[model samples]
Target: MFATAARNFVEEVDHGGWLIPVSSLNDTVNLLSVVVKRKRFWIWQRPKYLPTDFHLNDILTGDTPIQPVSIETDFIKYDGTYGENMKGSVNANVFDHSSFNVEGKDSSKLQSSFGSLKKEELDVQKLLRDSKNRLLDMSHGLVQQTMEKHRQVFGIVKERIVTTQPCSVIEEVQQGGNCGGRLSFCGGKSPKVSLKENGSLRKDSDVTMEIPIHTTIAYALIELEIKHDGRFELCLLSDTKGGFEVDGPASNQLLGASRAPMSPSESSHLKEELEQLGEHFQVLSALPATTRASLLQHITKVMENKEAVSSLQQVLEQMCQGKRPVLEEVTATESHKKSIQAVLDLLEQCGQTESAQANQSTAVLAALHLITSAIDEMTHECYAVFWMCCSFTGLQTLKKLVHCVSENGELPLSSSGLATPTEDVYEKTEHLFASCQVSLKRDGDTVKTEIHQQPGHRPLVLCIAIKGLASLDQSD
Candidate 1:
């Protein structure tokens, strides 16, 4: 029974753990009968219940040889638990003690070096920020100074042209010899005028004046002559020869001869007319000599009388209206048309050259204004000089002038491709001719007459033209 119980206990323990019974099996079986059962019976039952290779002989006894469990002791305890017990002290010293001390010193040196490197990086950042701030401040100051200088220069230029009150010759004559019978002067200096009284009539009274060219005001001269019959002539002369002589007339009979005696009002009117004419010539002096000569010749042909002036004005007015002018009367003669065409071609070439060189629309507009003002002045003087002479050449010249202005305005002057001032000029010119209706017709004798319906309207074309010219004049 004892052997059987021992074998069962060993088998149960090998499979899992030994299980104890709650009730005693001593009353169910006889102990002697159990003992009689063979050990071979348990061996056979064990193979069926557990593994086939399991056996009683494989079971370990208390005297069987065993290997001990391994415990690593090559590390130090960092919790200050070393030497608290004999086992901990013995294990703590297992590692090299001097190697840890050397590692600690190296770690301290690395920490110190890292702290210094961070401080240097911070200092470099601060220097970069300061340099950036200083550079911005310098740029701002430079820009402000440049703007201030430009403002001062602009103010000085604006103040250069003095707009004096219009002077009257009658007023000057009344004021005595000191007045010199001179009108308003444009630049810093006035022209030198010498008058000689030949008789009671202003006719045969030789009046000689020296006008400096506006462009080269220091050297060039326009020797002016006033005839006995109130006719005025211009000769472009230079001081390069030391004495003023005939450089040739600006235009053929620039002002027509007047036969009648001048009344007080008429004298004042004539003086005013001549003064305005002088200003226009002054502006023209800025252009090339050839251009000036050609324009002057064309002007002389056109300014014969009121009919011619009216005809010319009508054609120009039509041009300003953005419509083609009817040139039947002016172009009736091929010679007249060819002459006028030549003048137009010359003016167009001049405009093109100027436009090509000009980088700004403002510059082109200023040139246009100057040219128009000169034309206006010439037209006015012509109208005042001869109210009787009738000529179609004047009308042709007017057409050419309008064509020149339009051509110059159409140039691609600005980078933006839009000219604001040129548009304004066109608008004003259109408005000037809106109410005036003009017609040209030949009478039974083939004498052409310019029929004008409205006479009181004043044109603003000249005013706008002068605005840009005046600026250019100041700059020059």
Candidate 2:
């Protein structure tokens, strides 16, 4: 009955769901004690038939609690790129309490017990061999799936290249006009045929195609550039009326037209008109101030009066009643040049004094404006003289003007920063003649500058030749 009771108690306590009985003994009856454990493998064993203090310190003192060290078990699989081990490693210590019986304290030898547990030491050699075979099979399947994904993307890129080349070929045929009225293959299609593959095309012939007559790579780049920056759009020519007509989802139309050259007859007529204008300007410049003002007023009045004969000649005739009816030829002599210089000097001297005074006096602003305008007129006459001299001598007279106006005040163009005598004016007009080609018309000794000229117009020898002439005239 005692054996039965002890066995039943041990069995009930050792039920793994809730408890565990680590160790036990039952022979004495004078002093009795029972110990039981709970789940998580915690042990609580006691000596039966003994006093409480007889073995109290042995069961409870000195390292009574032990914590298990951790271990990892990984069921890793391998791929073709690199193989990994299906690894399981133990790094733990065992808990024991045997020293409580003899030394009156709890003690453990977990490290040595864990090291000595070698049931699978021989079995690991066979495990290594088995892992390699399993990894190889996994690697082959992984590699096959990766290669299939690459093939699918490559197919898409190839299709785009094939579809795009034909658009260029169509443009080439239209521009060259060498298709012999037969459409050459644009990505393998007849040039005369246009097609829209968009879902909008309900019927086969409903496709729209237009060839670019003057195709340029710049036009293609413009279309591609906006795609990266913002929302991209296109419009069909048949749908939209004007500027935005050609922009659409997949429409191609060339954007710019080539410039047409002016014909010989049109060129001759323009030259004649320019020459007449030049003559009128020279007459106006040479006229006395009051006489010029009167002529302008008369012309304005005639227009206001709505006169039937309001031509410039008729207007001039009405203004010059008692004065010399026609202009008399005055040869451009040394005396003429000196007289012109003297008048220009008087005008500039007054102008510089007024310009200096303008900053100080708000009341003198209108007078300053009038003086500045006269200075501009004198400057224009100086340019006319310089250009006329060049025409007569066949020498480039503008070199001195360019040199004086240059930042360095030197003949040779240089990158070095240098100061000029007239720095303010020089900075503004230094590059004026570097781009323009001028042509002069010589009628007797008077040379007139014309805008329209023959193809033989000299390549930009120099444009404005008398830049520093105003400053010189002022000094004189």
Candidate 3:
């Protein structure tokens, strides 16, 4: 009974220690079968569990026979009856008659010298340092060459026209002059040589004409291409008082008084606009990946327009009535929400201001304000929605769902595999039609999931279901 208990304990420990994958267990068994070859043998005398007097004396004499070590001895007895010649093998270290050292010992002096050697004693450090320096030099040269090549490939931009305002213009007309009063003495001297004008010319009336002239301003426009780094080589395109008329205020003279220093308020507004544009560019450049994206979308619907608000109210009204809002129906209606249509119409109206006839400065400013307001409103609404979604589903669950979706793609529905490739979505969508309807409702911080059975009214209603007669409530 003691031996049986010991064996059971040993088996339990061994079983706990050895772990194998289920698929590979059969492979391990097959290998063991070939190695051991099924056989039966009688049990030999059991070895002493503790060291005995013989073991102590054997250590003193160092000439006692050692017990053989076998893999089979670990758990079960092995009989070599199937083999013709059966010889027991013992671990070489088990015997004490032979020399213990596998290889001869090294000289003490050599070992001591090896231990004393410093980093300077080896050439490896120097070789590594030299190699690194060479690598750095090569890298520097390559970078320089690359920069030079780029400089040569892309030519400088030159300006073709120069505009300037001229100072002034003069217009004159000529007519024959009539001899008037000369000095008294000159009149006497000229009396002998003076010629009289013809009668036709004497009686002719004087003709005069006025001509229009233009004056050029003092400002001159100098156009040049510049680098993004703010380091620029000025290439003279043209010098003029007035810059390109096509560029509006932006193309005015750089040195002239056209671009006067802006007021502090103007500067602040411009900076804010630039910063907002940069932020928008960054957001758009990055991929949209967030667990709250759906919630954000819902919030956007709530905050978008008065129409969206009305729609949400209608949903709430219907839900109050005897109606179960079918998630599918809600999702379909969300796709066609009049609030979304309002946003689309707003965008269309904004686009109309871009027509050639609508190129006034006021129109441009209005368009800009409209776009900025829309974006700001949308972002705030979306964020509100995200929090609402978080309130409905605990933050932790939402985070886990996000990570799972990111790593595992879609959730594993009853029949779905670990991951369904998007390419196969159209084919597999039919199989995934059983999602929880409760997960798709739109309510403030809560989604009502209690099943409702009502036969007369519409089959499903949103949170606030408003039916035929009740729709009149909207008019009120």
For residue 431, model 1's alpha carbon misses the true position, in angstroms, by 34
- Give the alpha carbon lDDT tens digit for every residue of 52-75 in model 2: 221111222233321212222221
Model 2: lDDT of residue 293: 41
Residues 369-436, model 3: lDDT tens digits: 22223222222223233323333333333332322222322334223222222333321221211121
Q: What C-alpha lDDT, on a 0 to 100 scale, does residue 174 get in candidate 1?
A: 10
Strongest candidate by TM-score? 1
Q: How far is candidate 2 from the true structure (C-alpha RMSD, Å)?
A: 51.2
lDDT of each: 0.26, 0.22, 0.23
Least lDDT summed over 10 consecutive residues: which range in candidate 3?
106-115
Residue 161: error of model 3 in Å? Answer: 38
Please give the TM-score that candidate 2 achieves against the real structure.
0.14
Comparison by lDDT, 1 against 2, better one:
1
lDDT order of candidates, top first: 1, 3, 2
Q: After superposition, how far is residue 104 of candidate 3 from its true place, in Å?
A: 85
TM-score of each model, in listed order: 0.20, 0.14, 0.13
* Positional deviation of residue 263's Cα in model 3 after best superposition, in angstroms: 13
